[model samples]
Target: MRQSSAVFRMIAPLIAVGVLMVGCGPSPAPNSAPSLSPMPVPAQTAASDKPLRVAPAPSALTPPVGSLYKNPTNNRNELVLADVRHTAVIIGDSQAMPAGSWPQQGVAALGYKLHVAGMGGTGYVAGNGKTGNYIDALQRGDWVLPYGEPPLIVIEGGGNDATQHATDAQITSNADRLLAALKTRYPGSRLAMIGTLARGINNGGGRRTEVDALLGRIAAKHGVPFVSAGDWLTRYDAIGDLQDGVHLRPAGHAKIGVVLAQELTALGLAARPDSAPAAK
Candidate 1:
């Protein structure tokens, strides 16, 4: 009976240990409910739960101060005005570039800030190695257009076209494309053309004057205002103003600016009354 009792006690402890081990074993997965955690475990959200992102639209940049904006080849350029109500955009060749140019003087007199783009040897259909023609440059994004709707957009050039001997057909085609593009781009703006400056036939003018006249006809067809400087050298007796057979000196440009301003005023194309005149 004593031995039997001792054996029973030993077996009892073993059985208790086995029962405790079984109680501490891992539980099976649930069938219906998910396991609950006191602390949240960070899990990747579904794609739909994420906020949507979109790219920004393009917009114009305003300059804080008056300065020059140059392009890649330094062929195309802009004259930024710090505070301007009306802008006069001029696209041409060397004639439109330089400070105190006729276009610059005329626009300034009309109380508009000037934004001019031109290469030395480029025209409607003529391209220099560094830059393309006016239409080409505009299409290639060679120059940046000024922000807002310009009050006046002037197409200037044809000197290089004549010099390069581009056909009338080529000039007309390119000029038409450029005019169409400008009209489409700035539907609210007024369009005009400043013809090539040239002497009369008697004063050694040939292709240059012809191109100027041709441009006048194109402007008329498009119903755009045309200012002819074709006969200015001979008519105004300003041949002496010519630094070369073609280009004008600074004084000559200043004199021409006065005359051109007068002509623009006569055509009722001066700056709007709301436009603030640049400070002297």
Candidate 2:
């Protein structure tokens, strides 16, 4: 009985040790919380709350033809003569008063009465003097008739003078004296002296350049505008628009008229349509 009891004790201890080993084995690592990785974020887009959205691309604005007249009182639709007593004067040589004059066309288009006092063959020096016999019809009173109010005077000489071998000093001096005299005669008038057209041949005389330079100086001295007809006309010629080698064709004249009208508007000689607001 004692021996049987000892064997029983030893077997009991071995069974107890096996149960402990089974309990100590890994139990799914204690069922720990799942390790989560960081989630990726989405990209952002532009957003606006405003109702009125701006255009991606905008277009440029263009001004109307003959819409640059600087005159505050003159209306775009109405002729200057309808309101004023005197007429605008255009003085030039034959080319200026061509078969169809650009000045005349320009004035008419811009709703103005035209009074041309140009002598075809006369130069600035000759016109101012009685020796040329060009201004014979104009009496002393008529000399200042075109200037009671500030009139738009288009002076278009220099072509003849330039071609005639006039010296730079002579040309400038003549232009200066003439402009001074005109200013003295008519203080309020605005003068625009058109430069001479280009003569193709180099006559060894600097007449063409001299006349242009003098016109610029004269314009500065008189505080008036100077338009280079030669420059503009040459551009036209480059585009194959000249009838003769020298004179402007009808289309050319019209182009010149358009340019002149724009110039007139800029000079404050014409009025804008929407000058005064409506009585609302």
Per-candidate TM-scores read 0.72, 0.54
Q: Give lDDT for model 2.
A: 0.57
lDDT of 2 by residue, 28-82 (tens): 4564643477464343445644445434443332223323323333222211233
- lDDT by residue for model 1 over 198-270, one digit each (tens)? 8976777799999999999999999999999888888877789889878889988988889889988887788
Q: Give the range where candidate 1 is weakest over 10 consecutive residues by summed lDDT.
A: 55-64
Q: Assess the local accuracy of residue 109 in candidate 2 as a C-alpha lDDT between 0 and 100.
A: 59
lDDT of each: 0.81, 0.57
Error of 2 at 154 (Å): 2.0
The lDDT leader among the candidates is: 1
Clashing pairs in 2: 68-265, 68-266, 69-265, 70-265, 70-268, 71-268, 71-269, 71-270, 74-271, 79-111
Which portions of model 1 show Cα errors greater than 4 Å? Answer: 1-49, 54-84, 275-280
